[model samples]
Target chain A: MIGQGVLNMNTISDKVMFYRGALVPMAATFAYSILVMIYVIIRSSLTIYGSMPKGERSLILWLNGFSVAYSVMIFSLIMAMVSSLVGAVTALILKKVLLHFNPQFQWNKVLIISFTTALALLTIHYLLLRIFLNGYMTFDYPETFLFWWGFPAVIFLGVVVVGSYQFNKALLGQHLKGNSTSN
Target chain B: MKHIKRFVSYTLFFYATTALIYWIFIRPLHLSWGATFKEINKAMPADSLISPNRVVTTRAINIQAPRERAWPWIAQTGQNKGGFNSYHWLENLFGASMVNADSIVRQWQHPVPGDTIYYGKHQGYQTISLVKPNECYSLGGWSFYLHAIDSGNTRLIIRYPSMEVGQSRWTSIYYYGLFEPLHFIMESGMMMGIKHKAERQK
Candidate 1:
């Protein structure tokens, strides 16, 4: 028992700490998905609106936006789900391996693990993009695509590191408070 | 022995990463950067001059501008003109003197057939063999074609119908190892640059 009870006891906070390793990236995906949704609707609708007669442009834009939204919503949702799921799975695996070494969480290790995992996942994501949703990326070259998306991934990597670090810190705090780390 | 082992490890790591990066990213793009099947196979005006024989490389982009709007950017592509509309920094790093224009200049809006297009001292030059205003601009073995998808959008295709043909084995290695990748990077940059300029105010 590292805390109030056995970490093996499967308590609510323990589960939250275990699974919610994915929470930050999940939140990021939700946020980025909405931005992508709005951007697509605006950009696609505007291009279509240009083909319309002046009198019907406003109506055309509105209708086109709706249709485009109907089409892209599924893609946007799927991307978010994929990102969150990947992040969650990565965190779960890493945390399990780390926790196996000891019941207490180490802050420095958590940060390093989270950041490296984000980079690896993003690289794989870029490659998998060629096989799926390549059109959605729109950039003619992968370098250009990476240049645009890499900054955001780096930003999220920071968030993930901080989030993972905090969660591990809390677990460590609990362990320290309990005055015992023996499993 | 420890020092020798460390040196060997570093060398192996370097080579491993270079090979990994080449296979994963560089090789695929150099093969056919962003070309669609239809775009790659579609016979172009350049085909008459170059002929797609051994190794064909076709790349294209969807420009969110009318064919008319995007044509001027393509028209102005030459060293003495508006430049190749590519990565000026990279090009200049190789003594290309590339200065990609941001706006369509009136004088450069048209190119007469038989004009020479410079790819700088590094990549040699091409001769303009055909010009069809907002339709096709052919420079001997290379060309750019615009297909209007709608009033507001165009499919800009860059076709080098014959990238290479039956050459010596050593030349083939040079083309694959060096020339193809460098060309892909510059060409892709040019496509994006054209798209960026054409899409402006469009």
Candidate 2:
């Protein structure tokens, strides 16, 4: 009966593993994007109002401003979705790579692998930004690139990796307790 | 259904965590550039641009050159004058026919208050509001200051103030969201250009 129970728990864990690996990172990326969007809007708004001259305070001006903000928000939302998908794929790839090395999951190994994956993703992102938004992401604003893109990518990867690990551990722990109780 | 709920909960957690990290670590760093708490809060001559309820941005850089060496670069910044030592291509894209000077031009070095400094052909001009040779100057709403930290180093400070012309929240959002980031990139490049010029001259 104990052997049967262990097998049952393993099956359940196997079923949930894919979901945990993919969804957790996706959700984290989406959330981070939303937070950044809000921040950018607020900061940008204060800057605009401060700079506008007294003569330019017309209804048409305000409308134009709102239209621009609305357009940017739309663009950001699309990018956020793309980033979420990328993050999910990265998490899944990391899990597969780690499993190839060791069947048993190790927190230290997970951290190391995830960090490397994050760095690789950051390089890809930087290249993409350079190719597309060359004007905005030029070498002149090295600090901006580091702060705006690099820092956030690191934090996102760290949070998703650790969060998913803790969550899976908790789920396994609960299943074990349930089996013991039933016995 | 359960999976969807879990995903939503985890997303909220990540959002809160990321937001907290940015607020605590990143926002403060971006808001003020190389300025101490006292220096950022201190009233500047540019404060007169928008006396009350004004928004001010302060950015500073440490130049290896003396105040005098950096002063010439600042003095000749305008559309027709020695163009703001920033990216000429980028400035040109914004309708500016800028040719950044590699060395100091003796003719453009002497700028007095009330003199007009054009930004671009059709964009606008900033009238020189204040001038203190090798020390400080204010043009329209922006003020530039040079402090001699020692014989070899100078702290270049710039203060930009804009009046809050009672607009709806939407106006502020638009300005910051679309225009401000672009402006920051150009301005930051300009600052680096000045530093590069000053250091090379030294």
The global C-alpha lDDT for each of the candidates, from Candidate 1 onward, is 0.63, 0.62
User: What does candidate 1's lDDT look like per residue over B1-202, in tens digits?
Assistant: 2443454345345445554656565565545555777777877766878754757688876887898888898898897789987656545544555677777899888698988788864457877889999999988867888999998889888877544688889787666554665566567667766776777754
Worst 10 residues of 1 chain A by lDDT: A3-12
How good is model 2 by TM-score?
0.48
Model 2 lDDT per residue over B1-202, tens place: 2664686676556445544544454334544555667777877766676556666677776788898999999999998899988656545644466778888999999999999998865567889988889988888778888989999999888877653657578777655444444454456556667877888784
Error of 2 at A102 (Å): 61
TM-score of chain A of 1: 0.63
**What's the residue-level lDDT of B107 in candidate 2?**
98
State candidate 2's DockQ.
0.04
What candidate 2 gets wrong by more than 4 Å, as runs, is: A1-183, B1-27, B163-166
- DockQ of all candidates, in order? 0.01, 0.04
In candidate 1 the C-alpha lDDT for residue A168 amounts to 64
Residue-wise C-alpha lDDT for candidate 1, range A80-175, written one tens digit per residue: 466656666766655664565434455566666767766776787678876785544445444344434754577567766776676566666665
**Least accurate stretch of 10 residues (summed lDDT) in model 1 chain B?**
B1-10
- Clashing pairs for model 2 are A44-B176, A44-B177, A45-B172, A45-B173
